[model samples]
Target chain A: MVVNSSAELTDDEVDRIFRALADATRRDIVRRTLAGEASVSELAGAYSMSFAAVQKHVAVLEGAGLVTKRPRGRERVVRGNPDAIRRAQRLLDAYEQIWVARIGRLDALLDDTPPQQ
Target chain B: MVVNSSAELTDDEVDRIFRALADATRRDIVRRTLAGEASVSELAGAYSMSFAAVQKHVAVLEGAGLVTKRPRGRERVVRGNPDAIRRAQRLLDAYEQIWVARIGRLDALLDDTPPQQ
Candidate 1:
């Protein structure tokens, strides 16, 4: 049998990803980490918020698969997960495609109808 | 001066668009309407929810500029707004670009660093 990948995420997973992305701060964190891997301490230093608050934000992104942590010596490094971002982008593309198809149909309909009533 | 277009949406507008897309049911409604223009009644009939619930969902979409209502005789026709969708997609694209640029910088850094001690 063919195995399903993360692309086949459940409704709940989809909800989590979108919800995680809804917050501006969380989105910023994703961008920062995507630029370079950073330890929790470094991230905490960059933001005005406390270390605990930043940790919580990181936890949310982790939970949503937007970021991943790996042990680097004593500290854990956080990096953005590009695959997850692409997956989310794919969903938006699918939504756009539907709209495009609808517009195409409307154009055809208009062409088919006579000019004057 | 050239007028600022919808592309320069304020933070609140960004929040609304993302929040509107966070719900699966709302996302489904977007997909359905994007596939074809749908009336409030026709949408409600397709879903398991009541007419009020469907109307509320459409209202949320309309408020976010994801969809629009056009008065056609007595009934109001709901059509997905492609420009709004494109605006949202552009935001996502910007996010993706940040990640891509980050990876590029990392690659450059790695290349610059000496491989061995």
Candidate 2:
């Protein structure tokens, strides 16, 4: 099911999503936003970094489509995009399928033949 | 299920895993290795880059615990590690759970009241 939903993501998009998620601060930001949307200022206040650094991290997440920014009273509110998360989930699912099939083959090889019922 | 298995990986390991997966060529190598084990030379031939380049990609993958290399006579054979894949899947699974719960709350908020059966 995850793999079926995977076609919409470009390899570049996958690269960006994974790269953006590779950092601790960014992942925490994603977690925070996914639970409830927050502004850059709110996120920065929670971390030990400067507002600009946190803004950069938010920008990376936005570029990867993992989070979205919308104007709200002169502040940009960031919310994690579930669809983008699902896309990355699906890419990993495809890889999971590959190994599942490979393991199935290995099982068959070890069995020598189908077991009698 | 993936979330349950996610406890085995530390945040640092999760970072390494995603960082390694952020590259297109590295991701391709993971797919190929999951499908079937191959020597470094064989993998190098399949790509446009030099053997050392492919080797570096494999090193990154290995560092992230995504793949394993074993000596086979004259060369090292590479195979994708299912456990590592599962660990990364679990991390995403945690994020998925967060959003799923958030959506449930949103649905509750949008509902005027419980629908009559």
Instruction: Using lDDT, give the best candidate's number.
Output: 2
User: Residue by residue across B1-117, what tens digits does model 1's lDDT show?
Assistant: 112245487666776777888888888888887887878888888889999998999898888888888888877788877677677778878878988887788899899999797
Clashing residue pairs in candidate 2, if any? Answer: none
How much is the lDDT of residue A81 in candidate 2? Answer: 83
Question: Could you tell me every candidate's TM-score relative to the true structure?
Answer: 0.83, 0.87
lDDT of 1 by residue, A40-102 (tens): 999999889899999999998898888999999999899988777777788888888987777
Q: Model 2 over residues B13-75: C-alpha lDDT tens digits?
A: 788899999999999999999999999999999999999999999999998989999999999
Superposition error at B39 for model 2 (Å): 0.8
Per-residue error at B76 for model 2, in Å?
0.6
RMSD of each: 3.9, 4.9
DockQ of each: 0.65, 0.78
Tens digits of per-residue lDDT, candidate 2, A1-117, equal 123244576788789989999999999999999999998899999999899999999999988888889999989999998887878888899899999999999998988876679
**Candidate 2 fraction of reference contacts recovered:** 0.89
Highest TM-score: give the candidate number. 2
